[model samples]
Target: MKWTRDSYRWIALAAGFTIILVGYAMRNTFSVFYPVIVSDFGWTRGSTALMYSLTLLVYGLFAPVAGGLADRFQPRYVLAMGGVVVGSGIALCSTPTSVWHFYIIYGIIVAVGTSLIGITPVISVVSHWFGSNRGGLVFGVLGAGFGVSLVTAPMYQWLIATYGWRSAYLMIGLCAIAIIAPVSLLFIRRSPHHIELLRQKDTDTGGSGTTPGLSGRTEEWTVRRAFRTRSFKLFLLIGFCNMGFAQQVTIAHQVYFLQDVGYAPMVAASMFGVFGVAFASGNLSSPLSDRYGRVPFVIAGCLSTAGSVLLLRITPNPDSAIIPLLFAFASGWGLGVVPPACFAAMVDRFHGRNYGSIHGTMILFISLGGAVGPWLGGQLHDISGSYFSVFTLVQAFLIVAAVLIVFATRPASMRITS
Candidate 1:
């Protein structure tokens, strides 16, 4: 009946995963609300999409600070605070008086809040706990928090239909605070080895019988040296291209895209929900990257994403719904593959005391891409009256992303340029 040190990592993983579900569920709900918000406010499509971009921009900007904070302190403190900020923003969004208000409240405040509890902190902490072997699998598991969207996507639509958008936001916000805040404050550990923590149970000796924390890691890339490395730059660019260009457009607009092609609201949402499941499937399978090399999975994901976009472009409407839905799931799966692989790659090469900061810096560039992608997609769609060009651009970026990872995967020990 006595739990091992290793069991603590799984416990933390489960806690972190559940906490993140609130933030991601809120984020995914945005795409579903994209049309409704625009219609309610009479905003142009580009302007509306710009709101989402702004949120990403803000998320990008604050991500490093969150990363630094988590690196310095415990994830519990950062996440608890993030839950508060995110909850407040969501609740305030219920009564946005104008576009500027929405921009400041949801775009800025919510973005910052989510950043506090976002990928950098959550994944970094988990990575520290999990060590190298399970990195791909655990990261994938963390990402499956996004899979909560499968349930949330439909729930949001139903709420919007029955109670209305305002009520939906209010309810979701309150629940986010109620759930995420206490759980984070109560459960998360920065890593297994915060002195006071390890004293209690020595969980840092990781249940796998390996010492957790920064015990075996070497080649501690200072933030400066990390900046100079080819790998870091490549990683940044890959994130920008993959996450910024491809991911933004897909996450922010896919629901609308389906609706544009004549799919109904609930149906579109349900299909989008299917994508969430696909994302989880991909995460579950991400252990492949851990067993294999991160590069192969990264490359495969890029190709799969390109294929998904191509399918979306060609599919004609309500009739081919199942096909697009399948591709959407594949798209989610592909997305699920790359991040953990990329993070694991970073850990292998750059891990040191400052992994969180380095990852945060990379996230800044990625966020920049994410910040602009949705606006660009929306504006392009508005001007050209089609998404063909957007799809083309996505394919190009993803290919480049794949190529970048090829170089970034170079063994960390070989290159030590300061």
Candidate 2:
């Protein structure tokens, strides 16, 4: 198929959406895998959960390096290579005999692979296809991939039940390799500039479809300059507190938490699926942030998410299904809004040729927060004998997140480039 400048952006979007959906699914499956790993090994929740913390830490630390690579090289090669690494690492997981083996294999290897193919690089590539005018909308569409990945929770549970965790992981790894590699290589491009350059050779219109690059109008934002700005610092805080810490606390333990309270494993997984669907719904709604404003949506999302935890805390009957359904939908929708809006707001302020590096650095702080959350939740549970303290902490961080965004998105902060 001949790639027109107009048509190729959609193609890139679709490819990115697919890659993110599959890649994040691999990460999200950890929730379902959490209990099984614990049951099989009889490890303490805190120690067993530490592996996940290590994974987030490694992925966070490596994100800047991945983004730098995406900026300097062809994204196709970078993403395809990441797919291979992710697949290999997950497949190798079937062979680990000790907990430390997981720390090495899943924590370091798979984490690095995920960083390579994760939101940082994918957002960098997609940003090239559309200008900041559509950043929220396009990013919402892309962010939906993360939510949709969660929708596969039931399927993952079925795999674990039917095939056993080891075999299920091997199958998932193979699928990741098969799906991510070709789509990335065949469809992802360096930027619209390459497509426009080809279009210019074919006609005199000079590729009018291409969105203007940020560097043309704004002062170039190097990684160092972005770090110096107050907005960037606030963004880092929002990412760490809300996006990383509160979010990971839920993602890593929601299913297990539900099971501990009363719901059966499969039922808990289904509730997670409901959460995923609602999350996708919120992501689709994020385009409104582009119209109304990013900060309001973020603050609303944070409050809504925190409120959902209260529903979980007050669940009159986990057996009835209504409360879990409400909690899942409300929390998912609320959690979904902040990420695309926050990142879009960042793009509104900081996007440029060096944005990949800047975004990667932002993700690093988020990862650090993420690294703490799961382990902390597990430790809190270990000490308190319930998720009560864990849920309370989530609400506290989310509220703090909402307050921080108010400062992060201030008009004075938005105007600063250095």
Clashing pairs in 1: 6-207
Error of 2 at 360 (Å): 0.3
- The best candidate in terms of TM-score: 2
Model 1 TM-score is 0.91
TM-score of each: 0.91, 0.93
Query: For model 2, how does the per-residue alpha-carbon lDDT over 170-194 read when each residue is reduced to its tens digit?
Result: 9999999999999999999866664
In model 2, the number of clashes is 0
* Model 1 Cα lDDT, one tens digit per residue, 123-232: 76777677666777777788777665555788999999999999999998888889888988877865545434334324543466544564575554667888777788
Top lDDT prediction, candidate number: 2
